[model samples]
Target: MTESADDAVLALPDRTLLILDDDRPFLTRLARAMERRGFEVTEADTVAAGLVAVDKTPPAFAVVDMRLEDGNGIEVIRRLKEKRPEARAIILTGYGNIATAVTAVKLGAVDYLAKPADADEVFAALMAESDDKAVPPENPMSADRVRWEHIQRVYELCDRNVSETARRLNMHRRTLQRILAKRAPR
Candidate 1:
């Protein structure tokens, strides 16, 4: 009797991971942090490079950015899942949205996280075994803080142009400038 694909014993993958992001500083920091947490980290700065890395050897885990200069991170994640079906991946974005998050989960991503996520949170998400509800934060962001973050996000999206941000947000340019100058609310 010949052994089939189903009959073959599956080998557990090692703790190898790929981190793909366009932001050089964040990529370096995340790589160092993930290394400290015991993942053999491989870093790529573009979707093309990410694809090359995946083709070379598909990692057991990945953290891909939602948008990049070369292409969308979804392509990289798609290819990784194709090569390594058991791979667990996550999508990180500076701006979070429901549609993209839904797509990422459908493509085998374990979770989608907004930017500025700490190393501990990323680690926990990677290691979670069940699709259990996340514990709510005891001290969530205040309304003012949320508003400030929204403004900042819009500012960045508008290429940091104060006038453009103000116009898009339907606020006075001077008022937008004032908010930009102040420190973020806690």
Candidate 2:
């Protein structure tokens, strides 16, 4: 089902939202956050469960983590869109990459955001594009399409040490410090 920009703008009533993620802690945190916003939320730890949940009871919106233990989030998004074409979707990914981002958008995701994303950021991404509009070009990282694939590798190699991570990336410790400060809330 194809939806246009105008179709996205249709006001989303207060309704149940679905979130798909394999990490139990993250899923719990996300559900609580969305609940705080007056949205009833349901969570699934696997793509198959998420699909089944939507089939049983369609949600108003969905936030799907790109990587799942059993399957990828893009598959969940596809099934959700198929089951409930009107449900708005936002892709959440820790394994951010250009291919995944493009695939999510092509599969009908409203926006793609990196993991550790704050609840506000997640909600904004889904709502902001209710008009199905493309993200603004001026937005950094929004259009860059280059996922921080190197950052994780460096972080792992550095044993999650900010100083070492900075050194390996050939960037100032303070710069890496600033980026670390903005990691999504767990």
Candidate 3:
């Protein structure tokens, strides 16, 4: 039994899929959904477990969290690609950044997606058939909004220290304070 949202089946010779994430609930839900969608799902919560799975049986597809509690998912991607050169992998992360995305792709990840992405989006990323770039997001974030989001993320990573965050972002402390005090842009 499965939800209709995941009823659409994926036809492929090797439907084996490896999904690694520390979020237990998300991992369980995604594992179930992928199973219903015709994948032989193997779920792991840590990088070590992911590596074991990759070594024992390289999956045809993988969805790895960019930053696991134990280690970065790039190591898993690297091992999976070494074990199975044609494996398709995607990095899922809450802290999405250009540097890590580029690293993931360079290590043979098929795509990089932000956290909270739905099953359909993950499926689409894994199964893309061509070299075409991603289509524009239907509701692209405004540039102001993107800047705000980046600033907020950096701020949090800086432990909410305004001076450190401002210094790292190369913005005046007063300007950052003003932005932080306002509501996020739509």
Candidate 4:
């Protein structure tokens, strides 16, 4: 008799999970949910704090927000990999982009998920034995939505500087401001 894949995931004993996010409420909720799922959850609000926590006790798994108050979540994932090479990591972000997603994967993250991911999705990503089982997006973002998100991510990368963002994007400052002023397209 052999244990099924689901059984193997459920049988993972009280593994430690480090969750890094600036959103306090979401972090707390996710920590609790993962805890209930048999993980010892550690929470951090910034990349610095998360790095400190990782140094103190490297978790077997990590779920990191792509954006943090102090820095990008990629730093956390990189540090965790340094401390524990086999540690599984996932990147979660509200601002998803192809560049950042590729960077996350390059930095040793097993998966990248957009924001509003529930515990089930996070768990599945962490417990996955192979990338072959990765699910394709059910409803991929529209081109307009992708462009909007990319502009927003670039703006953030430029520290919310309208002029710099415009320069980097090769657009007029006023035009960038107008785009930023409007609500993001769905």
Candidate 5:
């Protein structure tokens, strides 16, 4: 009977979930909890590395920490969508900004969860996953909007290099030069 039950559990559909968070303890606990629920989890401590993980294996769901030592989580959500448009995204964040939360929702995340999100909350967001598409429709200022969504993406990709930022964006070095030139020094 035990053998039969084990086989039955093994027969269940496999769900791939990617977790991106800088907190090692939280990430490990989160991964283990989901694993107990039958999900295969992949983890990354940095946004740049997380993007590579998604590129290597597209996940059905992603739980992102809003803040990272290397960068913010929203950009990770946006990049995941770019890679696998259908992957459901849940933002697990300690820093809750109404504007950022609303902006995250606009980018295609299924839900924005505050940090300390429990297994139940994670499961609930996963259950609430939808293919309804990003809100407000796609637009020309998408680059700008996504840029505005979070500056971390650019920072992560550029390795904080402004010269390389232009290269990655495929714009003239001088063009990126002009754009940043307009911004007040941080």
Candidate 6:
């Protein structure tokens, strides 16, 4: 009895998901949570590792960080699309911006989500179809929250150098520090 190729393929379950993030703790926790949710999760801390994983076995779903210790996650999305055009990709970032979100969508990401996103949110983004109608946010971000997010983004871009961030923002270093010390506004 010879097994057909299609039969062999059907014998394997398809629940693979790839998660790439530079934050070790966050990556570990997210991977574990996804596993609990019944996905066969593969994780990478850098772009290179992620590319390798895509090459080996392109996942059915992917959650990629916008910034990595080595490179941006957009490259990973591009490569994944090359290998698996049907794969759903979501770009996750702590430094969210309209420009980057546009780029991510163009690179084949199904969604772009800001950081501190829980596993449930990530999963929802991954599972949502491209044609699904998006529900607009009930309340948009306040000016203070936008300012706080911009400051945080600049601080990360400066590699957490308070003085450099302040200089770039044209603000006093002490003032920047004080604002950074405060919790984000709603």
Q: Candidate 5, residues 1-186: lDDT per residue as tens digits? A: 254432433464647889999989989999998888777899899988887888898787899887888887888888888988888888887654456678788887888776667786776677652654433322223455445334435644478687687677776777766666564222
Which sections of candidate 5 miss by over 4 Å?
1-14, 129-186
For TM-score, the strongest prediction is 4
lDDT (Cα, 0-100) at 122 in candidate 4: 94
Candidate models: Cα lDDT each:
0.84, 0.77, 0.88, 0.90, 0.73, 0.87
- Please, what are the lDDT tens digits per residue for candidate 2 over residues 12-126? 4646789999889988998998877667799898989998988898887899998888878888888888888877899987777666778898988888887768787876676
Give one digit per residue, the lDDT tens place, for model 6 in 1-186. 996533433454787899999999999999998887778899999999999999999998899999998999999999999999988899998777776888899989999888888887787777665788765644657799889988887887799999999999999999998999988887
1-186 in candidate 1: lDDT tens per residue? 884322221223477889999999999998998887668899999999999999999999899998999989999999999999999899998655566778899999998887777776777677666567776654666789778878887887799999999999999999999999998776
Model 2 residue runs over 4 Å out of place are 1-14, 131-186
Best by lDDT: 4
Q: lDDT for model 3, on a 0 to 1 scale?
A: 0.88
Q: What is the lDDT of residue 47 in candidate 3?
A: 99
Which runs of model 6 end up more than 4 angstroms from their true locations?
1-13, 136-140, 147-186
Question: How many clashes does each candidate structure show, in the order listed?
Answer: 0, 2, 0, 0, 1, 0
Write down the worst ten-residue block by lDDT for model 5.
Answer: 132-141
With candidate 3 superimposed using the best TM-score fit, by how many Å does residue 156's alpha carbon deviate from the native? 10
Better of 1 and 5 by lDDT: 1
User: Using lDDT as the measure, what is the rank order of every candidate, best first?
Assistant: 4, 3, 6, 1, 2, 5
Give per-model TM-scores: 0.69, 0.66, 0.77, 0.86, 0.62, 0.72
For candidate 6, the lDDT comes to 0.87
lDDT by residue for model 4 over 1-186, one digit each (tens)?
997645665687648899999999999999999887778889999999999999999999999999887889999999999999999999999888888999999989999998878998898899887546788876778788888989988997899999999999999999989999998776
2 or 4, greater by lDDT: 4
TM-score-wise, the better of 4 and 6 is 4
lDDT, candidate 2, equals 0.77
Clash count in backbone of candidate 2: 2
Ranked by TM-score, top first: 4, 3, 6, 1, 2, 5
Off by over 4 Å in 3: 1-11, 142-145, 148-165, 172-186
**Model 6 alpha-carbon miss at residue 58, Å:** 1.2
Looking at candidate 6, the ten consecutive residues that score lowest on lDDT are 3-12
